[model samples]
Target: MAQLEQFTTPVDAVVSRMRALDAALPARDGVAVFNRVYLTVTEEVDRRVGTGGFPDPRTAITLDVLFAERYLTAVEADGPDRRPPACWRPLLQFRRHPGVRPLQFALAGINAHIGHDLALAVVDACRSLGCAPAELEDAYDRVGDLLVSLEERIREELMPGPDLLQIADPLTHLLGSWSLERARDAAWSAARALWALRGLPELTAEFTDRLDAAVGFAGRMLLTPLPD
Candidate 1:
C-alpha cells in the first residue's frame, strides 16, 4: 500500500480543486466540505455493513445515505453540474491514504451528521406513518438488515485492504459508511415516501435533487482545504 504522504498534500489540493471547478469556491465551503466528508464517511459505513460484525451498522448507513442521496437529488433539481465528480474523488483518496488518520477522525463527525439527519427524517416520516417509539426501532432494524445484505456484495467486490485507501478512496469510504443508523433512517424515509400515498416505489425527483445538492456541497468542501 502506498503511504498517504505519497500523494500530494490533500489540504493544499483541496483549495486548487475547488477553485478549478468553481470560481465561487469560498462562499459556501463549509457545507461543501461537510457534504464531501459526509459522503466518504457514509461510503465507509456501507462497507463495514457487508464485511462487518457490528450488530447495528445498517440503520446509520442507510439513514445517512438517504439524507445525502435525497439532498443530492434536491440540488440537481435546483441547479446544473454544480459539482464535478472529478473534484470529489481525489479528496476522498487523500483521506483514505494508508498512513492518514485525520480523514478517519473526520469520518466520525460525518457519522454523527448522518445520524442526526436520519433521526430528523425518521421523526418526520414517523409522524406520517403514525409509528410508535417501539415500531420506529423496528423500522430501523428492517432497513439495517437490508444494508447488511448489500454490504455483503460490496465487501465481496472490495474488501478492506491496504491498497483500498490509495486506489479508490471515494468508493472505499462510501462502502464503509453504511451502518445501522443510516439504514434505519433510510428505511424510515422509504416508509414515509409510501405514506405520501403515491405508491411511489422509485427514486423521486426530490431525492435526486437532494443527492445532487449534497454532491455539490461535497465537491466544494473538497476544495476548501486547498490554497488559492
Candidate 2:
C-alpha cells in the first residue's frame, strides 16, 4: 500500500500499485497478465488527464480514483478465504491455475473491472462529490473510449500466435465472446440504473449484488482453463 499512499493523484496511485503488482507477480501469472495490460491503460489515461483531454479533469480524476480503489481494495484483502465481489472472485481464485491462458486472465480482469466495478465506482464518485451520474457521464465516456481503443492492442499483444489461435481453438471462441465495448456499454447502463435507484438503499444493494454476480459469472467463463 506504500505505493498507493505515496502518490497524490488518483491515477498516479493506481499506476504505482499496478507497477508494484506487475513486479511482484510471476510474469505469466494470471493476475500479472491483466495487471500489465491495465497498467498501460491507466498510464495512458493519466497522460490524457494531464493534457486536458478530459472535459472535466476534476470529475475524471475523482471517478478514476474511486474506480481504481475498488480493485486495489480487493487486491489487498487480508483474509485468504475472503471472497470479493463476484466480478473479482474468479481472477483471485483462478489466477494461479496452470491451464488458463494469459489472454484469458487479461480479458477476465477487464470484464470484472468494467462490467461491475466501473458502474459502482461511478455511483461512489457521484455520492462523494454530491453530484449525479449525469454530471459524471463525460468523464465516464472519456475513460470508456480510452479502454475501447486499447483493448485491441491488448489482445494483439497477449493472444497466442496465429498458429495457436486457430478458428477451432477454444481460446479464440472464448476471447470472441467478450468485448470491452459491450462491457463499457453495460457499465454505463448499470451506473444510470444505480443512480436512479439511489433513493432506495435496499433495491440499490440488490441491484449492485446482481450486477456483481453477473459480472463474476462472465469472468468465470472467461477464465475457463484450457489445456496446453
Best by TM-score: 2
Write one digit per residue (lDDT tens) for candidate 1, span 65-119: 4444433433233325454232233333343333323333233223333333444
lDDT, candidates in the order shown: 0.41, 0.84
Error of 2 at 116 (Å): 0.4
Off by over 4 Å in 2: 1-8, 166-168
Model 1: lDDT of residue 150: 44
lDDT string, candidate 2, 7-51, tens digits: 336677788898999889899888788888888877887778777
Model 1, stretches more than 4 Å misplaced?
Answer: 1-116, 159-228
Cα RMSD, each candidate: 15.9, 3.7
Instruction: Give the candidate number with the greatest lDDT.
Output: 2
Cα-lDDT of candidate 2:
0.84
Q: What is the alpha-carbon lDDT for the whole of candidate 1?
A: 0.41
